[model samples]
Structures are given as C-alpha cells and as structure tokens.
Target: MRRLRPVRGKERRKKPIHDGCFEIRNPARLLVVAPRVPCPVKSEHISDAVASVIGPDFTIAFQPIVDLELREVFAHEALVRGLHGEGAYEVLGKVQAHHRFAFHEACRVKSIEMASMLGMRSRLSLNVAPNDIAGPAECFHTAIRTAERVGFPVDRLMFELTEGEPVADLPALAATFRSFQRFGFTSAIDDFGAAYAGFELLAAFQPDVVKLDVSFVRDIHLSAVRFTIVKGFVAICDELRIQVIAEGVEAPEEVDVLRRLGVRLFQGFLFARPGTAVLPEVAWDAA
Candidate 1:
C-alpha cells in the first residue's frame, strides 16, 4: 500500500481543478446541488459535524460480481444503505455539502470494516469519486489503515470510479490511478459508456476494468445496434488489456448476448440482489 504523506504548509494552499462542489448522479436518479466552494471549516470541526450527521446510520450491502467462465463470484461490490435498510439515495440524501468529504471517508472505512467482519475472501469493489482521489490523501490513508487493522489484504481491493459527474482533470485522475496501481490496487471505470465516462475516458486512461452501463446491457439481444456498440466497446477494451464487466444484466438473453461479446464478469439482478452485510450468492441457473 502507498504510504500517506503529511501535507506541508506550502501544499495546503495549492488548488486543484476539482476544488469546487460537484454533483454526482446515478442511473436511477439525478442529484442536483448548487456549486459551492470547498468546506472552509477546520478538518476536525467538520469531522465532528459529519460524524453527528452520518453517525452509525449507514451500513453496507454486498452484491456479487460473477464470472461466467469460472462460474464463481469474481468480486462483491459494497453498496451503502441505511442502518434500517433504506436505499442509498435515502441514506446519502441527508448529507450536506460541507459533510460530503467526511461522508465519503466514512463510507470507505465502514465498508471495509463490515466486509472484513463478514469474512469476505473475494476481491471487494468500492465506489469512489474522482474528486476523492484528486483531493487530499487522507481518505486513502483512512481506508488503508482500516483494512490493515482488520487484516484485509490491500491488493484484494478495487476502486470503481463512479460515473456520476464529468471529470474536470483527466490527467490528475490518470495519475491517481497510476499511483494506486503501483500499490497493488486495481482501478475500474464504473458505468462505462454513460455520461462522461465514455471513449474519451478510455483514451485518457485505461482502467483495469470497464463496467458497461446498464443501458448497453438492457435487452441487448433484442437490439442489433446495442449489440454492435457493445461489441465495439468489448473489442476496444480487449486491445487495451482491460476486462469488461456487464452491469444490470437482468435476463438470460442479455447474458447470452454479453457472453458472445466477450464480457466475462457480470453484475445485476439476474444473479442476486445485494445482501445486507453479507456476500450474496450468485444464481448460476439464471444465466
């Protein structure tokens, strides 16, 4: 794992491209927030405020990513939920702008802690924001320390760059990926072909994995255009030595079409719904 370096006095004032507030969206819904400056409060003060707001109200659910060829779970994605099992949107909706940074940090720490407690042996995939990596290194250190404390191997961890917003600094993001790679951590672009995480992102930096957006995998067998586009994407990823994982595959026909397109890793309802604090079992027969 990469060692976390302390920020020097000169380093504290340097500004990055993602210094302002940004919105993050998902396929299900769009979360719109006004653009704001970085939180001006002291780190410890904001941390206390965030802890009070987030508290122990959030928990993680594991959704398995299955490998068709191996007929086993390739990884388990950790999804955030409320302590009482409310959806991610409900849990995250309460987070104020100033609390976003600490909220993200808490999610990382909690996810790793829960996954470790669940005795998860498969690679654990966690959602991450580009800004999180591009910003301070504290979040990364917190995750690394939590993993080490819980005895989870850092190499088995994968960070999925969520395609919730446009990346303001591609070069910085790419550099962050390279740095993580040097530490035995894998990088992936989530929701590929969606929003800004398209061909441009691939050209800038080829992640270890590319998860095709749910749009591409939805009823693909019924649409030749979708198939062709997906085929082209698969071919491109193949040439780049990047593994492609088809997301939101809910039908057998979709699986067949994706398999023919060379997508071996899969994640969606066709396999299993996310298990609360446990690794969900895959439904092989469904595929």
Candidate 2:
C-alpha cells in the first residue's frame, strides 16, 4: 500500500479499465457466482446437497485488488448487485432484511482468506455499515487474528467505515478505533462524499485515511459543484494534514484536474482495474 504524499504537478496517468466480477463461496463450501443482476441458473442437482438460502437473487460480488507496488492484495471492497431486474438499492434492502452486517463481515473475512491463500497481504479494506461500529471488539478480533495467522500485516489492513450514518458519539467511536490502533491496525472512512461528511469524526477520530467517494470524481472536470466540493475537501485535508484519495478516476482529464488541485492520491480505472488478472497495474502505469 502506498502512503499518501504530496505530489508536484505532473501529467495524470490513465491506462487501465476494470470490468468488475467475482466468484462467491458460501459458508456451506459451495461455489457460486454473485451475478451482476439476478438471473436464473440451473440448480437442479444443487438443491439436493443444500437448499439455497441466498438464491440466485441479486447479491453483491466483491472485487479484490492487488497493489502492484507491494505485489500483494491490499484490500477488497464489497460491491452490490441487484436482483433479477432489481437495482442495487433494492438488493440493499433485501440484504439488510437478512444479515447485512454479518454478511459483509463474513465477506471481508472470506475475501481476506482467499487473498491470504494466494499469499497476498498488504491490507484488507472491508466496507461496512456505519451503525455496525457498535459491535463488541470481539467482532473484529477474529479478523485481526486470522490476518495474523495468515502472515498478513495487521497494521496494513484498512477497515473501511462505509456508512453515512452520523457518528452518534465521537469519543466512543474513537475509543473503538483506538482498539484497532492498539493492535497496529489502521482505519479509513470510505465513500466520504456520498455519505454525510464527518468532519468531527475525521478531525477527532483521526483515522489513518479518508477515501473521497468516487461520485465526486466522476466527470469532475465538467461538474463545477463537484469540483468545489472536492477542492474544499482537499483544503480541509491539507489543514488536517490527513490523506485523501480520489476514487473512480476513469479519464486522463480527471487525473489532470485532480493533480492541479493538489490531490496527490487517486484510484480508478484510469490507473488499473480491480482483480488479480494482472499484477502491478499501478507500478507499471507509473514506470
């Protein structure tokens, strides 16, 4: 994983694009593809072994990325998919109806397990609901321990707080985060733009990093409103000296604009697509 650092103005690099897809293995030790949208697949023989709890309905698939610089799989963000003809928003409701928090937690653990099997261990950025931060420390202890057992760097893993829910108690949240810090694990508040910006959390919690939501970067050059918002974000980060990352940068123009605004760190298709399909996407892009 590359630490965020200041960059002198230079040409933005845009080279790769990612078509996202993932294979999911259920707890039952069965393999299934988390379809982009809900689609009917032949399940005749499959029903004999175990009935489907999570049918072929729309569920999210997670894409794991390998950081080329470290030659390791740093983290995997959970991406949602819709049901047969259902949009992500609809599927989200279904997931919540089930065990949304538990599902993501399991997915992160599973993804990390897969990464570790492949000897990829830079960090794991697990997307999670904001409210679930209320869980007991035991909730995350297993993940930390698992990473350790697998020889993964505990400090390098990033637990992404992806929820937009307001931080009800900043001190309490910080206390929870401190536990991770004590164990040498770092944290990041992901999707900062779409969610309500938690300046208090950002300032007080002092997370290791903050991920600028991709929405803020999409076609940013054309959107004055987004540019102002990003500029303001960059300004605040500058003051706090906190690291900020621009996500979903797909065009050279976007990179150029962000560079001019003093945004040093960025991630998107313009740089490399997700998946271990090809390693060192970032390193090769720069070199």
Candidate 3:
C-alpha cells in the first residue's frame, strides 16, 4: 500500500466564473449574509435573494495594508456584509447569539462571490478559521477554483487565518498549509500578537505574512512598552523578509511611531475605512 503525496496537483473540473478561466458553477455555502438585503449580485446561491445593497458603482474598496513608508496596501481583506441590512459585525453578535451558524456559511459564500467579482490587482483577504482549513479540502479547493474562474489571482489573495482552534496534529496542519500554498494561495497569521503561537507559527508554518493585532496598534503613542514589543517583532520580520502588515492604524502619531520603529505595512481606520476605495485621498507617504 502506498500513501498519497498529500495532494497530487490534479486538474479537477472547473466551473469557470470569468472568461474561459473563471468559473463558479458550484459556489461555496455561505451561512450569514441574509439575502433579504439588497446585494449587488445575482447567482443561484440561495433559493431567493432580496435586492443588492451595493449601488451601481460595482466597486469594492481595498485599503492598503502597507509598510510604514505609507505605501498603498494592495492586499484588501475580504469583508462580510449583509446587503442593505446593518454591518456584518453587528449582525455577527445576533447570529452567534441566535446560533444561526447554518445561515453564516451561505452569507460567507455570497460575500466571496461579490468580492471576487470586484477584485482588481489586489489580494482579497478572506477570514477563515483554522478549522476551515482542516475541514473538507473540497471547500478550499472550491474557493481557489472559484477565484480562478472570477479572474482573481489566487496567489495574490491572502487567507487571513485568525488564531485559535488548536492544531490536533502538527503534521496534518503542515500538510494543509502546503496544499493551499501549492494552489498559489498564501496564508497569513492574523492577529499575530494575540495568538500564543508567535514564533512557533513563524518557525512551523512560515506564513507569507503576519498581521500585528490591532490592540497594540490602538494606543501605540502613549505606550513605549508597545513600541518595544512591536519593535522586536519587526526586527525578526525584517530578518526573515516576511512583510509585516500592522492592522488598526488610526492616528498619525501611531503611524509615525510604527514608521520610526522600522515596522512597515499598516491597515486601519486612519488610512481608509473598510469598504471605501482601495487608496483614499489621504496624503500618506511611505517615506
């Protein structure tokens, strides 16, 4: 008996969504976004969807997740929305409280389709549980295939893997990471400081990118301790050459500190609000 090489890189059937390459014949199952709200999309996803909240603009903004130099962040995190209803975060509490986990998947799938359709030259950062990665490989494969069909670069797209959910087996985890990598999709360890993995994930998984949790970024100026803490990570990241994208950027003072400290890459309300244009009119400089 022989074991598989994890994944044998096979050309499975594709439901191209764009041109001859993009397809989404079988989209993923989203469980949160309510179709009752107006969504600027049309698909065979749910039995019936209301209208699209997105206007005729057909634009999904990508706030730059950039270095301290103030460069534009090309990697836009895929945000979840509930069409014309309230924002996703508010609805999150409601859904979680009501235990509407089933609807959540349906919502997520719709969001992905909308974002992918609007993607252009930037990576759409989609939040995913570590469990999702370990779950049925078919789903993830579907995501990659869908991206290809939608004319989005799978390699450029970063799956923002939030911390939590213990890895039952280290080997299995590594194998999964490799599978996504092989598909040209990169993984990011979101909220790096919040997780205990810290250096462990860096050494084990060697993620392509690491997002500095927003907590440290919030009150960075008044706290020198935060500077020391973030500086240390920046030093290691510089050595590894792995880009450090700081989330939750708000104040010019905080950006000043992060820039001086040698930590590059930032994303937060200061730069541009989520759902706004990718690069705002703000005169932020990478220098």
Query: Candidate 1 vs candidate 3: which has greater lDDT?
Result: 1
What TM-score does each of the candidates earn?
0.81, 0.65, 0.69
lDDT of 1 by residue, 1-287 (tens): 11111122321112222322111111111111112122211122224655786776777777888877767666788898876779988888888877776798778777777766677766678898877775335435666667767776555677899987778788888877765565556678999888888887888887788899999999999999999999988888888888998999899999998898788889999998988734666678897
- Pick by TM-score: which candidate is best? 1
Residues 1-287 of candidate 2 have per-residue lDDT tens digits of 22532223332322211211111111011111111222222222222212244444533333443233343333455454543445546665655435665554544554455445444433456665656676436446556556556565444456777755676766767776765554445567877756655676676676666778888888889999988988988888777666676777778778778877876556666655544322223432531
Clashes per prediction?
A: 0, 2, 41
RMSD of 1: 11.8
Task: List the global CA lDDT of all models.
Answer: 0.71, 0.54, 0.55
Instruction: Tell me which residue pairs clash in candidate 1.
Output: none
Per-residue alpha-carbon lDDT of candidate 3 for residues 14-44, written as tens digits (9 for 90 to 100): 5433333222222221211111122354434
* Candidate rank order under TM-score: 1, 3, 2
| Total clashing pairs in model 2 | 2
- Report the lDDT of model 3 for residue 258: 84
Measured by TM-score, how close is model 1 to the native structure? 0.81
